[model samples]
Target chain A: MAKNLLDVRNLSIHYKIQGGWVYAVDDVSFTLEKGETMGLVGESGCGKTTTGYGITQLLASNAYLKEGSKVIFDGKDFVQMSTVPSKEYKGYRKIVEYHPEMREYRWKRISMIFQGAMNAFNPVFKVGDQIIEAIKAHEDVTDEEARKRVEELYKLVGIPVDRIDNYPHEYSGGMKQRAMIAMALALNPDLIIADEPTTALDVVTQDRILGEMAKLQKREKVAMILITHDVSVVAEMAHKIAVMYAGHLVETGTTRQVFKETAHPYMEALLAAFPNIKKEKKERLKAIPGSPPDLANPPKGCRFAPRCPYAKDICLEEEPPVVEVAPGHYSKCHFAEELYGELGGGESNE
Target chain B: MSEENNDVVIRVRNLKKYFELHAGMFKFWGEPIYVKAVDGIDFDIHKGEILGLVGESGCGKTTTGRLLTRLEDPTEGNILFEGEDIAKLKGKELKSYRRNVQMIFQDPYESLNPRFTVQKTVMEPLIIHGIGESYDERVEMVIKALEDAELRPAEEYLDRFPHELSGGQRQRVAIARALVLRPKFIVADEPVSMLDVSIRAGVMNLMLDLRDKYNIPFLFITHDIAVSRYMSDKMAVMYLGKIVEMADSDEIVFNPMHPYTKALISAVPVPDPDHKHGRVQIKGEIPSPINLPPGCRFWPRCPYAKKGICDVKEPPLVEVEPGHYVACHFAEQLAAGELETGEEAKEVIEESEKIES
Candidate 1:
């Protein structure tokens, strides 16, 4: 077996509600190689962010990872040990003792770059001070060493070192994002989970920032799990992609497999929803009617069946198991195999 | 109805908007510097075409939008809405002009008064326009407007406040108010920039759907090219408060004539892994609009700038290919021939500056 960086099996992260558990991530599983970029995509409320939180063991108070869920990352089982018992679960017993605390893996091993970086940094403090604090908090570096690291990180992220003394407000939307990336890289973590990093930026800035991030990933050999709604942004960086709809994995495959040959109806709707430059100016866009379902009480059958045009009787009666349609291509729909890549009516080989 | 059907509705020429920097508290004797927000940009909005005003932050896209809707008067130049100088119109006539052009603001939360209910919000525009004579008539109009905006089963949404509704619903209400007046042209300023991705398409589709239903022309101002590409019939690229490029939306995206247009196109993220990902990355930062560089406003940052001419002489908007107009000294070079990349242009600028000094 090849050595993988992050691997999970039967991963189920749940949220407490009044009547029943939310099942934010139900039996969700994927792996990230040492230096690969995997895109975790979904609609607004899907468990993409929660999955990131679960991997980092930073799940919120209302959320908890179920027992027997195995998450092996960097030779450490971040998931708690089983009470059902095993010889290898001796070291994991300590983590099992404390249910809430995250074994101090927040900043050192992996970090997350949240959406709206403007609010991530403090208003009062200068960007320079923030970077320095980030460095010192993770490692045993002195103030001077951290300051030097801050300058290096600033220059690396394309923001001028001179602007380090400036407050966060003085920076543009893109520049603020660079400062956030600089702070995140200050710890030199192996993996960075970025959530909608370029959501607020203009196209020009978005391209530049994404380019910088791609370059940094290449040079550092760091794994990036980018979560965004923009398919274009995901296509730019991520090698493999996953499309989530209403907390279910609709499609997951290589970029070529997904973009060229989208299997699920939700993916088809999402692609059609995007404005192609080839489209006529005054032409109407056919929107996907009916919003995502309520996670607390999702539908009996397919969560996306209400909005899905190709939905059938079976789709409304039972949840489709995620099956491998092709070589490493997975989708959770009863009719996915027959209807694979039929949205644009193009073959995967094409 | 298309843009040509109704004829040209709005035209702006040599529009210059400069804000005088008032002297601070201490001395108050220094010369007041002017912040030229909109510096000599010209474009036309044909009868009902969705003319997109595109640019990054501080490029005066929003300011130009405000000027079009007459939310703010220009410091200099004329905005001919239906062949009438909007600046000259004031008092009673200006109030009437306001009804002809309604403005949809960016933040739906801030634009709407929190205290007002959906019915009251939609009715304010009706009352101001002084249409639908009776109270019940006005209520009828409001319901119709709500239905048009996709707030279906209008009765349920009538009494709900802005806070009670979702972000998508609030934006729909904003659209409803704008539509209630039955305006010919609307300046929708960053309408969906704040909404969630899933909901943004819904709001955008509503705008386009309403455009067809009302035959209403919109001056859609947005920084996102994807939205602009889908929404705008004709497009204008603004750089440093000036109209740098103008052409049909498809033409601009597929075959960008101007260097700025090319850069902007390359900047748009293409969701195709087969595509070569290393795009033309413009480094540094957007120069301060307050102290804009001489010659071409973009010449300082333009990749194609050459010699002392760029620093000393400004370029005019020249017709490069048919309807495509680009404002650049090297527009011809790019139009007839492929010149160089942004990096190569930067190198040329460096050498030229060194020789001049």
Candidate 2:
């Protein structure tokens, strides 16, 4: 079997608050093969963004990764390299202290298409010059080479080459997002983390952009971790799926397995909540009763216990084990086996 | 259709609003240029019916909502509320008309005053309209409104400010404030777009419940077609400044006639992984409303547009079916699947294929 392009295990991230810590991400584990897309699906404040940022080590100052977390990319454990002492060096010396190598890895090997493309670019710089600067920063290329590359990228992303010389303000919202995608692919990175890349664009623009991106990802064979709250976008783009709740990964599986054989109640509710144009008309969406629990003081046991329709007393007393009901399909619930059996029967109880 | 339906609460005919764009510094120019935000739209909202206005940004859905609520004056056409033309109403008359109509803004965080407590926010409408004789009466009204909005134990939130409440709660407060006046018509502009998916259902259900209880007609404006279809009984698809299609929500979603409407529906991402829609991807971005095409506004990006007819003359909205209206010259042929897909659309489809290999 081919090696996994990215593997994250027991990844936990927390942000320091005034009084204590906000457990943003907890015990999340997933893997992605080259050219595969894994969607991190969740609501706001669910820590999906934190997990994406943690992969690139681009988290804010207040955020910290918990000990024992592992981010193994291409067989190299970044967590271990950043924290553990080097065996080849003298005593009490940590290898790659402060991650000076991370700067080289970032944008060169892994790039990010951030949310809200409006604020991602410098207002004063020409969009073409910005992409050229990114190319020049990563590779030993002359001005002409970088300019030619930027023009090629613009054509690849379906933006007219003439618009490349215009300022970011001169471009439309969709064009700005296409420019952001161009920059993320400027250096031919092995992996790209797109955080809600098409959230602000219209549905038509979003569909076009996602189509372009899927084609681009497949052609380049670059792995992707798509972080978004829109389930439909993920269902269309992602090969694998990970459903996140308050601060935990509630479910992970192939997109088909996750959608067709959903085991977790949170994932079920999320799918039911979204209004589908293809569904039968006038079906009232089942709304989860309460908001997500406060991260500073999350609920005991299963974090989604309060909102889960099938939650029982055991769900409140102890943390549910991550049960693998099917091959490569995992659900963090005490009743995963039972739910999987019922879901397999093609009848889901309300 | 007869205009004098007793059930209709609000009737708009040939409504147009043109925002003047000043060229240079001349006060009196040769000819004043207009943005033509909401140019000649017509629709009727019956009591308890939700007429969804769906379009992309700059498509003038919001402007139509504002015109209906009387927030902006129309340059042409009439907005008749309960048989009275409310377009020219001013001062005390307009203030009284406002009592029967209210608007719920898009952002709850920015819409509500930070300093005003829930009690004050809900009661201000009553105070302005002079609905209640005493402060105690207005307080009671406020509490009732809050309860109606599903903010259970309304007293708990009466003293709290907007900052203290959750986003959904703040929107509920905004709804409560709108309901305090018992308005005949409501203009909800993207009420649930800002909310999370789980919480969004609750707000949308709440609005549905309110409509059932009060029989208040609503002009629901949003860019999301699925949400619009779910919330509205009748749906209108807007392009630039005109209603390209109008029909029952299900008919419009399932059997759209207009090319633009078909493109919009096909563009929406379905949550089901196996669902593969026939891709009717349109080429290019939406044209600027300021410099709209002379003929059909959507002709430039339309997949089935003809060169001479579509570009030479504007198509008037005609009822292709009994209750379905479409503003396209080849609406009948398109609905029958006889019209060929334009070359540009085929090229766009080839260019946007997912994973060519």
- In order, the first chain's TM-score in every candidate is 0.89, 0.93
lDDT (10s digit) by residue, model 2, range A1-350: 23888899998877777878799998889898988999999999999999998887787756666767888988877777665543532222232435876778889999999999978999999999999999998799999999999889999999999898899999999999999999999999999999999999998888889988988998899999999999999988999999999989999999988988888888888877888887764788778898999999999899999988898999998999999999999999999998885542112311
Off by over 4 Å in 2: A83-98, A343-350, B1-4, B26-29, B350-357
Candidate 1 lDDT over residue span B1-357, tens digit each: 112433778888788888787657523765678778899877878766898888888889999988887777788898888878896677899889999999899999898999999999999977876898799999999999999999999999999999988788899999999988889889999998877666788899888878777778899999988789888888899988888899988888887777777878877776566665336534456788888888887776666666687777888887777778888888878777767756765664464344323
Q: Which runs of model 1 end up more than 4 angstroms from their true locations? A: A17-23, A81-103, A278-284, A345-350, B1-6, B22-27, B196-198, B338-357
- A94, model 1: CA deviation in Å? 15
- Model 2, position B93, has a per-residue lDDT of 95
Q: For all candidates in order, state the fraction of native interface contacts they contain.
A: 0.60, 0.74
Clashing pairs in 2: none
RMSD of 2: 3.0
Task: Give the alpha-carbon lDDT of every model.
Answer: 0.79, 0.88
Give one digit per residue, the lDDT tens place, for model 1 in A205-267.
887788778878888988989998888788778989888776677788888888887788887
- Against the true structure, candidate 1 reaches a TM-score of 0.90
